[model samples]
Target: MNPLTAIRMEALLSGRSDQLGPDVAERLSNHPLDSIDTEFPHYARSVDSPDGIERPTERHPVFFGCYDWHSSVHSHWALIRQLRLFDEHPARSDIVDRIDDRFTAENIAREVEHFEDNETFEKPYGWAWFLHLVSELCLWEDDRAAAWRSILKPLEETIVTLIKSEFLPQKRPFRVGTHQNSAFALHCILDYARTLSNERLESAVTDTATAFYAEDRNYPVEYEPLGWDFLSPSLTEADLMRRVYSRNEFTMWIEQFLPDVTTAPYDTILEPVHTNPNRDEGVALHLVGLNLSKAWCLAGLASTLKDHQYVEAFERSAKQHMECGLDRAFTDEYAGSHWLSSFVLYLLTRNEGGIAPE
Candidate 1:
């Protein structure tokens, strides 16, 4: 097993946004920094893989880079967020210009058409990211963003209907750390729902979450990161529950679902994961994401249960997980760098009311 990167704890725990600003800017600034732009890694079922596929750029007009479709979508979310939060930063004007040019109605219409006849296009993962992109646009103070949001609303309604009808009622959670992970998707969409006051969307997510996870108890907790994992199954569940339940209910729930977050074993979820991308280049990069995402989840969880005995433990563990990967993730192998910054900004610039937009 590869040892953790061993970065200083302070780097992750610090309050200064400027510390990671340059890294965030760089990740979104370049022109499709990885080969996915060239190789076009569109994952498709055999039934859907027809004889001749158009190139990635031709297929995905609005989001055709950053390694994969979902990564490209969230990169857009991150760039919009960075521009809004760091308004006076030097890169702001250029970012504004870049977005203005790309977010045109024609490009957005092409993006909408890309979903034609594809039933499982993006599913909840990519669906959630698209909503996240819209969520940022909702809060952004620019006419260009307003125009883009107008063009994007039809697609948004399409996802909201799909989730309510198909995705949520499956009544099964994808208990993994990757794209299919239900908790991660629900977490992002739920936040988007609350921010936009979409009561229907919010109800669909909370209902599914309660049905899927309300009774989960004594999660294996130890058997996570199964080789190619990227999110903490049990921890992500706990994080989402915080949003669904009141303080007292969530505290009671966490005590049983993960009884060791603060004591004895102190929970294996807290330990920094180690990875050697050289061994399995693609799978190993997930460890970096697992660490950053786990950190944000921990931070969000701790905020809700402030008076619990394990609050400090959650906060400390969050920093440790972040220290393990936040800085290193930026310039690490392309497998990780092309997309990790979106999660980085989402966590670091997180507002007080949990994951809801600032």
Candidate 2:
């Protein structure tokens, strides 16, 4: 039998679905390894002048694969996360080699140059995931991780500078359920800030999150899971607020934001989304990610609202979304396979234990 198949069988027998054991690590690692270096069929999302259009590999030497820039960044994070969680896995050395090859200082310098030229490029989403990747490397104790972190420091600083200068100053938050969602970006930035003990960035994110969403009440959960949405605007906002507010403060804030938390529209938000199999691959597959992202947000909310009346319902919906998401996360179609594993890994590890504040 295939080794991975055997591992999955063992996990099934042992009832280890929720555990981040070697079996799960092995399964999740395959997605990144499969697409991280596959450069074709790429979505550059780049701006070019008449001088020339450059290939994605040239434009983004370090993060030019896995369909698009953000997906590639998070896929790298997923690989590093797998390595951190299961050091003894058979693919550890291969994972290390791949990271080592891609994380060269020169490559990162080129990536930095691209971002510098295109100031608004991948503003929050891609930038958020890049910092997340850096956070993972920063926390890992391995010498290799330290080396990569040092190499990545320049780009990391560039992104932080951009976030503070460009994004935080906006008077209003983008409350959409897509990549532009301000709440989701703040969620990621806050976690990265706290992980590295960067007080300046932390304060900036706290202030911005509070200003953008602290006054929110009666969130329109009914309008969620918008056509191609992978992130829930309401849930992501609540999750980010959980990190910013104290437990007591968050308790009150959530009660107001998601009032009547267990009924109609809220219940509708909890229900896992299903995509019509016949729909276009790019559009429909987002629902798969929507399920995983919802699971992540709901799980974070449940963790913070442990004593709330709706906690049990949140937990139940989170599980349902997780199962529904995991069922389709490992697809062969490039549309889903290129990026969904990162969402799977993120949800499985609860954003690598960065859900709540220290």
Candidate 3:
């Protein structure tokens, strides 16, 4: 049954700033800086690289940390977001210094070279986070923001073009709720597109959303959240649909998509996912993300639908998910630590369709 039916407002986060307590700010401030330059313990797609490809740092100038390309980009997004939200976040000045060092014209140019070598390097996932970084920068409109925007233009343009022409056309929805998940990536892309008022990018994402998900009914939620998943294929799709359809239309569509969600008390899917944290492997730590991701999805859906049926249960479920994953996010496991806080920030901020900036 849909646990979102009874979600409440009290359980919803008051704001993203609440998650950045002194300790949390310190933790976030240091996490990415510690590894933004370290190269190993990373994953890269060599298929797109030369036979003797360089290490992660050598290949990706700016985004070489946090286990993989997308992680690094999202980490950067998290860093900037944290700094923007809190003026006195102990590490604010240092973050600006670090950003200046990494987001230089020469460095971004090298990153563009890498992208040229591998046109579909990160496909839509990394592309989305890159856009997320750009979107965050767009919120600034400072001289530094303008410089960074211009410097990253080539790479940004390529990604936007691919989403409209190449990626969207060839794409079939990936419902796995992982890096390959189309809904999650498209969700990010759509958010970025809307913020910039890029009709081309916005139209492509909206059309793709309609084509891929509009016709779906009786979605198979029972098989959801595969063991290694950090995303909820069902919920992420529902969240995306919320943006694509109007309130009346989305309400109608969501009820069909998750009929079980209409059930009272909404307890069937409320339990936090269990994982064997003793294992430090990346696969084992995804449960933390699963919980946080669900929290944001529930919160996002409730805000979008604005229906009484969900205000209570959705908020409670989101709070529970955040509680389950909060401590686990700051872990010793690089597999989890490097990435989990970013997800936490995303949920905590609840930056729905660009409202945070305004």
Best by lDDT: 2
TM-score of candidate 3 versus the correct structure, residues matched by position: 0.89
Model 3 score (lDDT): 0.75
Question: Which model is ahead, 1 or 3, in terms of TM-score?
Answer: 3
The candidate scoring highest on TM-score is 2
Off by over 4 Å in 1: 1-50, 262-266, 277-280, 352-354
Residue 283 displacement in candidate 3 (angstroms): 1.7
lDDT rank order:
2, 3, 1
lDDT of 1 by residue, 131-152 (tens): 8888888877778778878877
Cα miss at 172, model 2 (Å)?
Answer: 0.4
| Clash numbers, per candidate | 1, 0, 11
Q: What is the C-alpha RMSD of each candidate to the true structure, in Å?
A: 3.8, 3.2, 4.7
Ranking by TM-score: 2, 3, 1
Worst 10 residues of 1 by lDDT: 1-10
Query: What TM-score do all the candidates reach, one by one?
Result: 0.87, 0.92, 0.89
Query: Per-residue lDDT of 1-358 in model 3, one digit per residue for the tens?
Result: 2122243334336544653455566676566766565567887554565677687767888899888888888888888777667667888878788878878778888888877777888887898888888887787646777777787887788788777765788547988868888988888888888889877878888899899998898776767667688888988898888877888998888877874664633345555685655654667788889988888888778777775586677777877787777747777667777788788778766753353221
